[model samples]
Target: MLVRKMDSEVLVLATDNRGKIVELTDLLKPYHLRVLSTKDLLLPDPEETGSTFIANAKIKALTAAQASGIPAMADDSGFSVAALEAAPGIYSARWAGPQKDFNLAMQLVHYKMIISKSDDTQAWFTCALALAWPDGYCESVEGYVYGRVVWPPRGDNGFGYDSMFVPDGKNMETFGECNINRKKLISHRADAFSRLVNRCFKGRNFDGKRLLSFRQK
Candidate 1:
């Protein structure tokens, strides 16, 4: 069973990516929870030695919660391409090199697929979210979205591999080309968040739009 203790309004969000922060903040704003970034707290980044997304998320959440002495939440997301046998699943960030140049990373994926002549460009995005309390309580949830890889990339809106990822059934719009609202609705993070809300936040109203506030007293 999933649960969130209602004692604290301050929750640390453990990520340095501003895009992720903005998206998460927008989604969580309705709950009236005060979300603080690791940067805001001057928290150090935890080493993601985990071999999986869930493990990485747990490592981050727990690290932040223990360091900041507050409740913390973290997420790990990545692209898993069928052709590459999920080559970049856990190494998604590392694949971009130290500078985080995703263009090179995307090119790497594109070439590997081409060289293999793997007609199947099928892929999916996976996101794992973990929430941890300072006293050691923790919970995690995962979500995914299936899609196909597109070559040469397109659009300039999103970061990472967004420009080359076209969700299934879509003719031409990569996530980068789509509007923020559309992307958010079908994103892996949103899917994970829905589960997180259902499991942890019992009785709260979340209709995927405006969230009505309900708190445990």
Candidate 2:
């Protein structure tokens, strides 16, 4: 019958951070999907009780989905320290302190790593993304990017740990220095969101396959 159906997947950005919404909106915009901001709905940030990234993301996504009955999305991301044996792995965001001073946080890490440079100072940024559909079909995806830390807060492009992280091949620039599109290409959040959006928007399943090769399931 050549029947066509409209995509009802309204991606709800579950965050009060306008910068994050803008970054994520640009990433998801290619799908031509409707993206809603948390501020638009006056949704209060939910208490994050989950101990892990996926758990936290799921909590936010589920909360939004329950409230709006739309497919909602959330990201829980953080830094992990190799020298500390990953002590601050899940505590990255909280480590920013009352002032949200990532420079201080970077200093603390730099000191620790300098003393224990023998260890794999190799750190990774991890993002766990959750998608909550109105029909109760929820899915979670995770992405990780390995990199080493830089000092003195190089640039002003990105927020949080991006200032300290020099991703895999890049030499001089921190993630904060890289443009939004460049950051999106090799970011943890992008990896997870790529999986999620491909599945939901394109009716494809990525599984463990490359994003470009996503096939209809």
Candidate 3:
């Protein structure tokens, strides 16, 4: 089937999370697209019923794309510890409970690791990105950044479990401790987003120069 061309430049991001909106908007800065979040449009969030990151991302993307009659993008990401056998792989956010208190969630993770009596600190963050058109056509990709979990959670820069994750090869600085530019350089979201852009936006008539102009505004 022939995929419909994206005639509109506006792309709705299917998420209400402010942190995600900021990260995604920053990532898409180079593209000649106007980004809008579900919160900005006051769109209802679709339930993430999928079993995996890719599936969940597709659900959000398709829902927003169809609802707004425009192309949309969504991201589903999580933190998994090797010792826990990735218990919170998909339920990372749920671990924070209804309050969305990630501090409590981090404490829970540390507690679980202690109860398990496993010394393994090996962990990883996974990100899945999905891009969907109004007609339901979609593309999805996943990326990962392997690292080890730290104790006493350091830094206060990033959201979620960033304070505890120290990506491999970094100078022992947790994501929360690193500046946004440094974190973006090796983040799972950045890896997946790069692939998505290459797959969907490359070779298009997107004006690269507009990125500079948009930033200036």
Candidate 4:
């Protein structure tokens, strides 16, 4: 049964990414913690205008915490394309276009490389998870997974750029080509969430706009 209480030691994850939710579900459950999503509260999502992944994650976390007056969490992450000089970094979502055309985004990347005559298809996935308390305190942890980009696409399992992301040493397929358990083992989001579990604890204090303070105690 869903509990209804303001002071409950709950975590409001500030994201709408279902893939991430699925990836993080198990890691969060062991704490016996109440996990809530923006969808559950019908909350408005904040605009991710931050220039960096950390900045964006923090923005969303604080927004949810402030909006719901509870401890909240968020993650902002994407792929860094080496050929494009790490471009489409913050633009990963937009690259898929306003309609989120994953196919077009994949084609665009391949086309860009094919035209450039550069096979530097090295890329990596990254995610930064931010946690914030009602008092305005916030903390964040990051995750990274190195991988290579594939051109023809691969198996269909994961979503958004996954079909074209092939991890190093395994030339078999893309992230979409791998199963959920396999994906979790080497995914960036998984790494970040793991860090959160290690260093994170309840209760903290707020510093200011530039930053906030969170402690193990």
For candidate 3, give the lDDT: 0.87
Give all candidates' CA lDDT scores.
Answer: 0.85, 0.74, 0.87, 0.77
**What's the ranking of the predictions by TM-score, best on top?**
3, 1, 4, 2
TM-scores, in order shown?
0.91, 0.83, 0.92, 0.85
lDDT of 3 by residue, 1-217 (tens): 3333334578999998887888889888777688898888888989999999999999999999999888899999999999999968989999999999999999999999999999999999999999998888888889899999999999998999999999999389999998998888799999999887666665556574212111110
* Candidate 4 least-lDDT 10 residues: 202-211
- Give the C-alpha miss distance for residue 66 in model 1, angstroms: 1.0
Winning candidate number (lDDT): 3
lDDT by residue for model 1 (14-131), tens: 9989888987887787667778999999989989999889999999999999999988889999999998998799899888999999999999999899898889989999999998
What is the clash tally of candidate 4?
A: 0
Q: Is candidate 1 or candidate 4 better by lDDT?
A: 1
Off by over 4 Å in 3: 1-7, 206-217
lDDT of 4 by residue, 97-130 (tens): 8898888988888888787687788999889999
Candidate 4 or 3, higher TM-score: 3
Query: Which candidate, 2 or 3, would have the higher TM-score against the true structure?
Result: 3
- Of the candidates shown, which would achieve the greatest TM-score relative to the real structure? 3
Which portions of model 4 miss their true places by more than 4 Å? 1-8, 201-217
Task: Report the Cα RMSD per candidate.
Answer: 3.8, 6.0, 5.1, 7.1
For candidate 3, the 10 contiguous residues with the lowest summed lDDT are 208-217
For candidate 2, the C-alpha RMSD (Å) to the true structure equals 6.0
